[model samples]
Target: MTIMCSAESPNQPEIIIAVLAILLTLVFFLIYKRGKSTRRSILLTGICDSGKTLIFSQLVHKKYVQTYTSIKDNVGGFLIDNVFLKVVDIPGHERLRYKFFDEHKSAARGIVFVVDSLTFQQDLKDVAEYLYNILSDDVLAKNKTKFLILCNKQDQTLAKGSNAIKSILEKELNTLRVTKSRQVESVDPKTSKTSVLGEHGRDFSFQNFSLNIEFAESFGNHNKDGTNDIDQLVKWLLKIA
Candidate 1:
């Protein structure tokens, strides 16, 4: 018996533990990668009649859509420059905007805030308020969310250009900051959710944000050349997608 017995394998338990560890690591890594890939969603938002729906239609169908007031959200998936994206067009009605933001903020990679270039001046205060709410959101700011102020309907003769839109928005936001600061001060800080915009005692500018904020022009309608002038917007989508 002493001559025939063989020693047991000394590394069996160690080998089994090593194998299990590798498998668990691989599984966690795959789950993380899948979650990251699935978060490639962009949100289209702004005031009503700002051309968000038209732009959404143009992006998905490559043609202008005659839309009525949207009562619900529009969502779709499309390929741009070989990258797939999930885009959501949230109804811009003041009552519904915050609801949409709350629902989509967790997964949104960026926001395209459409501005009705022709009517922006009239809606300047409302626009500034909506934008202030977004820029000052605690979660959005914490995440450093990207924003694109898309001045839409640029094909209209009186439509303001991006530079003018940017200048006007900055001025309006500065005024808004003062007003909002007073309101915030009246409320208890622990109960208030609004964050401060820009630095105290300094003028508000998009440059002051840690998030990437850009301005661009778009024409959801066909241009004089009969081509959709959404190339810049499409390019932005592709970059973020």
Candidate 2:
């Protein structure tokens, strides 16, 4: 028997080749699946103030959240192996109104409109109405959008209440409309035509929009909205992404 025994089996090379082929196939499959499911979102609106920004900042920095990460251009990123979300913060002020409107009209994956309940009542009706106008634009209504209204300054005396702000926003949004004529009375009497939601765009009033209000207590009282809560908000945003 010792005269002509072979040291290696004839099938050894075939087995090695088969094992490598199987591994290669698995890697290719994983790559394809990842390519198919990558997700990206852009959050663009000018609602950042002292408190809201804090909540947002917390969301970005919090380690446990693992949802969103900060990106270039002040945008936040929600990163998964296959999917990534990009969130943009818009400057909330009269001077920035034009640019804000322009971005809103574009196709944004989600919208977070932060409001300060303590100060919103000063001119809540007008500001809410204005927001409705931009959201109602034809281009925005049709896109996939999630709406969040951050009511900051909740620790304040008058703003601590939640239901009041929700009701105010609901009412203001419902009354918004777009008329062909600049003057309200000039709208066609015959057609009775006003741009109602769904015909042109998504109406923030029609319940199609998911509405939620979060109060960031530490937003500014503790060193500009305490870095803690901001991380929470960013985490929430990432979950949405």
lDDT of 1: 0.83
- Quote each prediction's TM-score: 0.80, 0.58
The prediction achieving the highest lDDT against the true structure is: 1
lDDT of 2 by residue, 218-241 (tens): 233445333333443455555555
Reference-based TM-score, model 1: 0.80
For residues 151-227, write the lDDT of model 1, one tens digit per residue: 99888999999999999999999898887777777786653234458876678888876678999998866442354
The TM-score of candidate 2 is 0.58
Candidate 2 ranges with C-alpha deviation above 4 Å: 1-39, 44-52, 61-73, 78-83, 104-107, 176-194, 197-221, 224-239
Superposed by TM-score, candidate 2 places the C-alpha of residue 93 at a distance from the truth, in angstroms, of 1.9
